[model samples]
Target chain A: MNLERLGRTAPAVPLLVLGLVCLIFPLLVLLHISLQVRGGYGLGNFIDVFSSGVDRAALGNSLQFALWQAGLCVVLGTPIALALVRLKGRARGVVMSFINVASSFGGPGLAFAFMLLIGTTGVLTTIWSQLFGQAEFPSLGSMIGLNAIMLYVHLPLYLMLSLPSYALLRNEWREAARMSGAGFWRFWRQVGLPTLAPFALGNGLQIFMWSMGAYAIPYVVTTSPASIDLISIEIGRDLESSVFGVERAATLSVILMLLAIAMMWIYRTLQRRGERIL
Target chain B: MSAQTVAPLASTGTTTSNDEADSFLGRWGALILLIGFLGIPLLALLVFSVATAWSGTVLPSGYTAEHWIGALTSSDVLSAVGRSLFLAVAVCVINWILVIPAAYVSVVVEPRIRPWFQALAVVPFALPWIVIAAGMQLTVKEIAPGLFGTVGLLVLTLSGVTFPYLYWAVENSLITNNAKQLSEAARMSGASLPRTLLQVIVPAIRTGVMSGSLLTAASVFGEFPITMTLIGGGYETLPLWTLRMFSGRVPGAGAELAAVSFATFALLFAVSLLITRIDTATKPADPVRPPARIS
Candidate 1:
């Protein structure tokens, strides 16, 4: 395989043009919507999105929820992924498949099922009452309930992303640590923790983007007017509620895209630093 | 779930006996974590699907097939399943076409451009499917107005989302195996590049290609946002159909949801098993990493 041969095969112009167009179109549309005003061109929409307290709150809440959910997912998912890649035998296969399937699980239907489980008189609450001898159902409607479900929804992806790196840790390293008389805490801190950090950060950032941008999980699980109103939900609500201001939704879409891009850049930089350390 | 929670001892102690115990703990630790984390939720889902009244209890009061029966009869479930299957197959075919040529260049044609092509393939992988859904919707609105709500739209959207998986699988196959040896073996016998690619390289990576396709199918089949936002009211895939079933009315809706989940899981599980077989078969028998030299 050679570069000269690749150049000779075709001009490469068409491919380059197509790639650039595909990459740029969505961002351009977002910018266009963000800058446009009532009847003409201006920065009013952008100003409105940023200046308005509600819009700012929604953006803040979205980030907060995304961070919490993604964090929880990474914490929970890493061990499961570790088990899948490192463990063996019949039982392992069954567990692996179950996690794989559950990772793909959820839709609006899942959101609704969770709603039933965690909501008032839901299965979980009912069980809680029976255990505690409570007369009435309790509320689980704060950020914790919403974020927990969101974490569960995104756990599989985080796990999948983190599994390879976790698997990359050879068994010999563990054996070496044991032979050296390193205790559980020492082995984890000196060998395991350092190895997994970069992976966790890279995977965490991706999970953060997912949790932040996801519309369905939050839409289904949370309080109306969404106590932790994220940007995606706002965009959807605007699209559904507004008569002709589809542009507003478009404007928010731009903001989200920019945030995602920025977050990814930061994530990659962190990964690069991690690579250097290793 | 297993009560076993033995942990591997860190490699510090001198005794062979201790090392043996550590090995046992490592294996058992993995097993316990697998059951506790993954097994429990899945078991919960299965138990709930069968229980006539799962509410108000840690365990289901009783078991029944009413949910399975309800799912079978439900028009929503049937149509959703049908649509999901169709979309997944369509995505598999479309991605396979784009990937074969791209992978060909990566492996057989030009090696220097390989890194760039591989990077381009993975670029989309880094982006969430939701971004693609949003981008696809916007791109469709501007490019081809009529294609927006059709099956063609769904197919194309899923293809873009899944292209990387297919590319990585096919490319990894090319890089890992004795491609140059096979191609040189063919070339010395007077086969053209295209012939060598189609006959030798294609067959060589067939396992990788199929595994990639299966992975793509599982992802696209389970995908929800693309169906919701892009396909809109016209197309009703399994996820969308399940969503409709739960969102709307009909008796025993919970049971139907459970049934669809089971069906979806079974279908994906079968696909994954086939992939696992192909992957293990394609790899070299020796456990060591293959030589780095690409053809």
Candidate 2:
């Protein structure tokens, strides 16, 4: 397959163009515009990220929302991952398929499905009002409902990512802990959590990244111009509806890309540590 | 939900007569949770879609099939569905032309450039769609402002956004199946480059590429942010259309939304089933990394 000997160019040219358009060129645009602040090329755009109240709040809110979602997924998904590890054969298949279907619901579609359960005058709201006579049910489009949707869509992913760590937890360790007169609480507290902590942290960090970058759900749910609370929504607003314009959005995108890279590095380090401990 | 509570109870099971029940609960807790999560919402959506009117009640006033019929027959639903289908198919076809050759060149024609292509392939995993969309919009708008909102641009951009899936999938297949060796073998007998790729290496990795394309189609089918950002105007896809009806506070939109959800979910379920069936029979153990993050 020596194309050079055959007097032909490698078909890498189109690949290069695709790369330029998709990654290289776009990043260049972001870099170029991010430098085009009101006065000229300086840290003005970067400063605005912190000095401007709305921009600062968007960054902070993205952090808060991502942290809460990732933290909850780890807490709620660990047992499911453990149970998945214990179950075997056809039963495992059935359960895994259920997880698969749920995971496939992904972002916006899952948000739509959950709307019936949590929207204003949603079925669950109606049922809750009838049962408790409260006559009020906060909709899923709110901050509370955002958490619920993130958890629902992400918990299954957590289970999948964490299952391998469960496999690292050998049954013989449990047997040894039991033979030493340790109760399950003592075993898990002293042995299990310590062993699985790094992987859980790693998995949680990945979810945090996903949640922080999430735009479609927040976009679909919010009817307003732009967000003062979320990075993705604010980026969108800057591009579409806000007077802040595409330059501001470009700056935010650059910042987000750097943050994502930093988070990924930390996750890789934690995953390495987890594997080593195992 | 803590390991403390669930574990201690299971510990007591080893010495107690209620061991059977405790162990059953311990082993099946996830299944029970999933049933509650996946099952309840689906049933609720189904009932609500078919229900005549369900405001402020645990149950609908009455059940009917009119909404489902309406959704299937409605021009809006049909057009949206048709548009999404066209986009997904267009994405699949475009990636086949773009990715397969690039993968072939990297794996067989020239191995030295593999690193660059590999690096670019993994970019989307860390890159947010909005970030990419912004950059892409700037790039496309700068290049050809008229093409900014066209379906052609969407097909290209989506092919970029979901590029990693097809790239990695086919790349893995080529590497594993030893396409370099196979291509060299074909060339030794005087086969042309096209002939070798079309006859030898392509057949070997056809299943891998096809399934990758199907999975790509699945992603495009549900894609929102890029489509919304790039072509939010002069277009109507299922996600956009459904969002419009819901967000506009369009009266009587519930039953209609449910009908669309039910239909969309059913189609999605079949595609997933097909993907799983193909993957199990063909795909090797996946790389240690998880699949693409939820889009």
Number of the top-ranking candidate, with DockQ as the measure: 2
Report the C-alpha lDDT of model 2 over A200-259, residue by residue, as the tens digit: 998898888878888777776655443235889888877676487677888899888888
Chain A TM-scores in order: 0.83, 0.87
Clashes of each: 12, 0
Model 2 regions lying over 4 Å from their true place: A1-9, A90-98, A104-109, A164-192, A224-228, B1-24, B108-110, B292-295
Ten consecutive residues with minimal summed lDDT in candidate 2 chain B?
B1-10
Q: Which candidate is the best by TM-score?
A: 2
Q: Write down the C-alpha DockQ for each prediction.
A: 0.29, 0.43
> What's the TM-score of each model vs. the native?
0.83, 0.88
List the TM values for chain B, per candidate: 0.81, 0.87
Of the native A-B interface contacts, what share survives in model 2? 0.39
- How many pairs of residues in model 2 come into backbone collision? 0
Residue B123, model 2: Cα distance from true site in angstroms:
2.1
Instruction: For residues B114-211, write the lDDT of model 1, one tens digit per residue.
Output: 67655555445444445545665666676787876787767766676566667677777877877868888999999987788789988888888887
* Model 2 DockQ class: acceptable
**Whole-model lDDT values for every prediction:** 0.64, 0.75
What does DockQ come to for candidate 2? 0.43
